[model samples]
Target chain A: MMVDQFVAQIRRLGHGVIDAVMRLGFAARFFMALILASGTGLRRFSLVVREIYFAGFMSLIIISVSGLFVGMVLGLQGYNTLQRFGSESALGVLVALSLLRELGPVVAALLFASRAGTAMTAEIGLMKSTEQLVAMDMMAVNPLARVIAPKFWAGVLSMPLLAAIFSAVGIFGGYLIGVRFIGVDAGTFWSQMQAQVSVRTDILYGVYKSFVFGVVVTAIALFEGFDAPATAEGVSRATTRTVVISSLAILVLDFVLTAFMLGGN
Target chain B: MERSTYDLWVGLFVVAGLVALLALAFKAGNLGASSIGSSYVVKANFDDVGGLKVRAPVKASGVVVGRVTSIRFDPVRYQAQVTMKIGDAYRFPRDTTASILTSGLLGDQYVGLDAGGDSVMLKNGDTIHLTQSAIVIEKLIGQFLFNKASGGGKSPSSSTAKAGGL
Candidate 1:
C-alpha cells in the first residue's frame, strides 16, 4: 500500500506537469495552423488579400494614434538629455530610432492584444464550451479554416502596415514636441535625422518583428479558446491565461528578436 | 449577413496603400547610405591605423562627404595610406585637414575635414597633404589608466583641463 501510494503521488505530479505543457502546445499549434492554412486550404489570393487588408491595413489608425504619443514622450526625454551635449538638433535620431526599432512594434502589439486578442480568446472559448465545434463538424465545415483562419490571417498580415503607421505617427509626434514644446528648429530636426537617421536594417527589423508578433498572438488566443474547460470555471482560467501569456510573450520575443537582428552581425 | 462589393473595394485599397508605403520608405533609406560620397586619397603616416575600415564616413562640418575607400601600407613612405572619398560639393583646398572623429559618447567613429585656404582644390587621386590619424578611445582610456598608475589616481576631469568651453 505504501509503495502504491508513492507511485500514485509521482504519477499525479507527472500528469499535472504534462497537462500544463499540453495546454501550451495546443495554443502554439493552433496559431501555426492559422498561418499554414492560409497558404494551404483557404488559399484564395483574393481572400488572403482581403484578410490582409482588413487585418493589417485597417488597424493602422489605432496603432499610429497610440504610437504618436509614445514618440512625444521619447522626444521630451531625449531632448533634455541631448541638450546637455548640445546635440539637441539630433532629437530626430533619438525619437526616430527608438520609435522605429522598439516602441512602435511593442506598443502596437500590446494594444492589438487588448482590442482583438481578448475577444478572439473568448469567442474561441465560448465555441468550444458550447460544442458549436461539433455542429460545424456535422455541417462539414473545417473549424480551423473558417473562423480561426480569419483571425489568424488578420494578425499575421496586419503587423507590418500597423508598424509603419506607428513609426510615421511616432516621428510626427516627436516633431510636434520638439518644435512647439521645445525650440528645436524644424529644419534642423529633419536634416539631422536625414543626415544620420536611416538605415535599411531599421525598417527591415520593424516589418520582420511585426510579422513574428502577429503569429505569436493569434496562436496564443486560439490555443486558449480550443483548450477551454468543459465547465464555465475552466473557460475563465483559459481566457485569463491567454491574455497574460500573450502580452508577456510579445515583450520577451521583442527583446530576443531585437538582440538577434541588431547584435548578431 | 450578406456583404456587398463596396466592402471589397475597401480591402483592395488597404493592400495597395501598404505596398505604396513600403516602397516610399525603401526609397528614402537609400538616400542615407554610406556609399554616397566623393573620393579623395589621403596619405596618413600612422604607426598603426587602429582598425579603420574602408567605406567609413569622412565628414566636413559634421556632414558626410566621402568614405575611406582603401587602407594600405605605403612601404615606400612606411605609413598607412588611407584613400578617402569627399563629396563632389565639398572642394578640399590644398591644405585641408583630415582626422577620424568619434560621433558621440559611443564609439561610432567617422572622419572629419577642416578646409584650409589654398588656391588649388584637390583633384581625385591627389593625396591630402595634411592628415590627423584616427584616435582610438581604447588607447585614450589606456593612456588614462597608465597615467593613473603612475600618478596615483587623479580624477579624469583634470585631464580635460585643456578642452575649455563647449
Candidate 2:
C-alpha cells in the first residue's frame, strides 16, 4: 500500500510540472498574439488614446511625489556617508548613479504594478465576470485586439516616460538636499555627476529596463484578469494576484537584466 | 475633433518624455554640449594610471579643458598610453606637465595639466613629456607598512627621507 501511494504521488508531481509548463506556453502564445494584433489595433487610435490617458496620465502625481521623496532620502543618506570621508561633493554622483542604475526602474515598476496593474486586472476581471467578453465574441469582434491590445501598448510606452520623469524629479530632490541643506558645492555636484554618468550605459539602459518591465507588468495584469473565474470574488482575487505577481516578476527580471547588462562593466 | 484633441495630448506627452530624456543626457552624461566646439587630440604616457578611465575629465588648474579619449598599454615600454581630446579654445605649451589626480579623498581619477613656460605651443598628436602617475592608496599603505615593519617602530618620515635621497 505504501509503495503504491508513493508511486501515485510521484505521478501527480510530474503531472503538475507538465501542467505548469503548458500554462507558461499558453501565456507566451497569448503575449505574441497581443503584439501581433497591436499593429492593427493602433489604427483604432481613439481607443489607444483613451487607454493612455487612463494608464499614463492618471499615474503621474504618485510617480512624481514618490520619486522626489526617494531622492531626498538618498541625498540625506549619501551625505552622511560621504561626509565621513570629506567627499560630500560626490552626493550628486551617488544619487544620480543609484537612481539611473537601479532605483528609478525598479521603484517605478513596483509602483506601476501596484497602481495601474491592479486596476487593469480588476477592470478586465469585472468585464469577464459580467460576460461582456462573451458579448463581444458573439458580435464577431476580437476582444483581445479591441480591448487588451491598446492597454498593453499604453503601459509599454508609458513605463519609460514615467521612469524618466521619476529620475528627473529625483535629481531635483537630491539637489535641494545636497546643495541647499548640506552645503555641498553646487558646481562640484553637477559636474561630477555629468563626468561620471554615461548616456549609453546609464540612462539608455534604464529606459530599456523600464520598457521590459512595462511589458511584463502589463502582460501579467491582463493575463491574470482574463484567466480569472467568472465571479465577483474571483475578480477581487485576480486584482490582488496581479499586484503580487507583477511585483515579484519585476524584481526577478530586474536582477536578470542587471546581471546581463551590467555584469562586465 | 475629439480624436484630434486626444492626439494632441499624446503628442504633448511624447514631447515631455523627450524633454526629460534630453535633460538627463545633458545633466548626467554631458551629451551635445561637448560637440559645441572642436577638439584636438594629444597623448601622454604614464607608468601607472590607477583607476583612470576613458572619458575622465582633463582639467587645467581645476577647470575642465578636455577629456581622456582612450587608454592603452604600451607593451614595449610597459607603460600606459593615454590619448586626450582637448578643446580647441585652450592652447598649452609643449613642455606642459600632465598628472593623474583624484578629485577628492575618495573620488574618480582625472588628468591635470600644468602650463609650462615654453614659448612653443603643443599641437595635435604631440605627446606630453612630463607626466606623473596616479597615487594608488593601497600601494602607498603597503609601502608604509613594509617600512614600518623593517624600521622597528622608527619614525616613517625618516625612512621616507632616506628613500627619497637614495
Candidate 3:
C-alpha cells in the first residue's frame, strides 16, 4: 500500500510537469497567432492609436510620481553612504547608474504590468466570459486581430518611452536632493554623471530592456485573458495571474538579459 | 472623450517620452560632450595603462579635445598601445607628448596632451613617440620607501635615473 502511494505521488508530479509544458506550448502558439494577426490591426492605425491612449497615456502620472520618489530616496541614501567615504561627489554616479541601468526599466515595467496589464487582462477576460469573442467568431471577425493585436503593439510602443521618462524624472529628483538639498556642487553632480554614464551602454541597454519587458508583459496579459475559462471566477483568476505571472517574467528576464549584457566582463 | 482628443493626448505623450530620452542622452550622458565631429586617430604606447579605460577623455591642457578609442597589448614590445580619436579642429604637432593623468586626489584617469614645438601636425594613424605611462600609487610609495631606506641624501634626479632604469 505504501509503494502504491509513492507511485501515485510520482505520477502526480509527472502530470503536473506535463501540464506546465502543454500550457507553455499553447502560449507559444497563441503568441504566433497574435503576431500574424498584428498586420490587420496595423492597417487600421486608429486601432493602435486608441490602444496607446489607454495603455500609455493613462499610466503617465503614476509612472512619473513613483520615478521621482524613487530617485529622491536614492539621492538621500546615496549621499549618506558616500559621505562616510568622503566621496559624496560620486552620489550623482550612483543615482544615475542605478536608475538608468536597473531601477527605471524594471520598476516601470513592473508598474506597467500592475496598472495597464491587469486592465487588459480584465477587459479581454470579461469579453471572453460574456461571449463577445464567440459572437465575433460567428460574424467571421477575428477577435485576436480586432481586439488583442492593437493592445500588444501599444504596450510594446509605450514601455521604452515610459522607462525613459522615469529615468529622466528620477535623475531630476536625484538632482533636487543631491545638489539642491544636500548642497553637493551642482557642476560636479552633472559633470560626474556625464563623465561616468555612457550613452550606448547604460541608457541604450536600459531602453532595450524596457522594450523586451513591454513585449513580455503585454503578451502574458493577453495570453492569460484569451485563455481564461468562460466564467466570472475564471476572469478574476486570469486578471490576477496577469499581474503575478508578468511581474515574475519581467524579473527573471531582466536577470537573464543583464547577465548576457554585463556578465562577460 | 473625443477621438481627436485621444489622438492629441497620445501625440503629446509620445513627444514627451522622446524629449525625456533626448534629455537623458544629452544632459545625463556624455552624448553632447562627446560630439567631436570629423576626428583623426593617433596612437601612443605606454609601459602601463593602470586603470585608464577606453573612452577616457584625451585632454589638451584642461579641456577635452578627443577620446581614447582603443587599448591593445603588444606582446612583442611588452607595452600597451592606446589609440585616440582627436577632433580635426584641434591640431596637435607631431612631437606632442601624451601622458596619463589622474583627476583630483581619487578620481578618473585620462590622457593629457602637451603639444611640442613642431611645425608638422599629427595626421591620422600617426603614433605618438613621447608617451608617459600611468603612475601607479603603490609603485610611487615603494620608491619613496626605498629612497628613505637608502640614506635620505639621494638627489631627486638620481631617483629619476633609477626609475628610468626600471
Candidate 4:
C-alpha cells in the first residue's frame, strides 16, 4: 500500500511539472508571434535605437570586466596544462573560440536582460498602474506599439553588437593573461587563432541565439508587465517577475538550443 | 519621435557592415595560413587524447607551423591517433617527438612537435615515432585532492608524484 501510494504521488508531481513547462512554452510562442506580426511598431525607430544604446552601451563596463576575468581564468588554466605538453602557443585560438562560441553571447545576454528587461517591465507596469494604456487605447493608438515594440527591437539590436564587443575584447583579455603573463608565444597564438577557425555557421549560431534570447526576454517582460494589476505594489511585483522570468527563460532557452545543436552531449 | 526611413536604412547598413567586417576578419584569419603552406601530412598515435580536437594549432618550439587535421581512435592499439598537416617549410628530423599538448591551462589541446637531432629529415607521409599523451588539469587537480584526502593527513609528495604527478 505504501509503495503504490508513493508511486502515485511521484507520477502526479511529474505531471504537474510537465504541464507548467508546456504552458510557459505555449505563452512564449504566442507572445513571440504577436510581437513579430505587429508592423507599425517598427515605425518607432528612434525609440528603439535610443533604447539599444541605453541598454547596451551603458552596460559595457560589466560585460568587459566579466569578459576579462573569464578570459584570464581560461588563460591561466590553459597555460598550465599546455605548458606540460609544450603547445602553449595556441592559446589565442582556444581563447577566441571560447569567447566567440560560448561566453560572449551568454554573458552579454544575461547582462542585457538584467538592465533592459527590468526597465521595460517597470515602464509598462507603470503605464498599467496609471491607466495610461487605457488612455492610449481610447486615443486609437496601440499601447503595444507605443511600449513593447521599442523594447523588443532594443533587445534584438543591442544583443548582437554586444556579443561582438564581448568577443573582440575577450581575445585581448586572453592575450594579456595568456601571452603576457604565462609566456606563450604571442605571435603564434595570434597566428593559430587566425588560421584555424570554424565556419560562418559558428558565428551565425551565436547571433541566432541572441535573437532568440531577445524575443524570449522581451516577451516575458511584456507579459508580466501587462498582467500586473492597476496598483504600485502590482507594478513592483511585475518588475520583479519580469526580471526573474526573463533571466530564467534566457538560460532555459540557451540550454535547449545548446542541447539541440550539440546533440548527444 | 519617429526616426525617418533614411535613418533606419543607415542603421541597417552600419549593422550589416559590422557583421560583414567581423565575418571577414575571422575568415581571413582562419584561411590565410592553410592556403599559404599546407604541405606534409603525417599521423601520430596517442594513448589518450585529452582535450585535443581538429583544427587545433600544432607548434614546434612554441611557434605554430601546422595544425591537427583529424583525430581517430585506433581500436587495435586502443589509442587516439591524430593526423596533422605541417607547412612545407617545417621539415622535422627523423627522430622528432610529437606530443598532444594543450594551448593553455583552460585552452584547447593541439599536437606539438619537438624537433630532434637526426640526419634524415621526415618526409610527407612519415609517422612521428615518439608521442607524449595529453595532460588534463582537472584530472591532475582531482588526483592532488584525492592524495591529500587519503594520505592520513600526511603530505603526499612521494606517492603523488609517482601517480601521474603532473
The residue ranges of model 4 lying beyond 4 angstroms of the native Cα positions read A1-33, B1-166
The stretch of ten residues in a row with the least summed lDDT in candidate 1 chain A is A39-48
lDDT digits (tens) for residues B1-166 of candidate 3 = 7889989999999999999999999999999989999999999999999999989999998899999999999999999999999999999999999999877546788999999999999999999999998988888778878877898875554555454332
Compute the lDDT of residue A71 as modeled in candidate 4.
79
Model 3 chain B weakest lDDT span, ten residues long: B157-166
Model 1 residue pairs with clashes: A31-A219, A56-A158, B38-B85, B38-B86, B39-B85, B65-B87, B66-B85
TM-score of chain B of 4: 0.71
lDDT of 3 by residue, A38-105 (tens): 99999998899999999999989999999999999999999999988777878889999999999999
- Whose TM-score is greatest here? 3
Model 2 DockQ class: medium
Candidate 1: segments with Cα more than 4 A from true spot: A1-13, A28-36, A40-42, A49-54, A129-132, A230-237, B1-56, B60-63, B67-97, B102-109, B113-130, B135-166
Error of 4 at A192 (Å): 2.7
| DockQ: the better of candidates 1 and 4 | 1
Rank by DockQ (best first): 3, 2, 1, 4
TM-score of 2: 0.90
Worst 10 residues of 4 chain B by lDDT: B157-166
Please give the C-alpha DockQ score of model 1: 0.22
Give a tens-digit lDDT track for model 4, residues A129-231: 8889899989997777766677677767767776766666677778889878867777777866775555554555666677788777767777777777888
lDDT of each: 0.70, 0.87, 0.93, 0.73
Predicted model with the maximum lDDT: 3
Candidate number with the higher TM-score (1 or 4) = 1
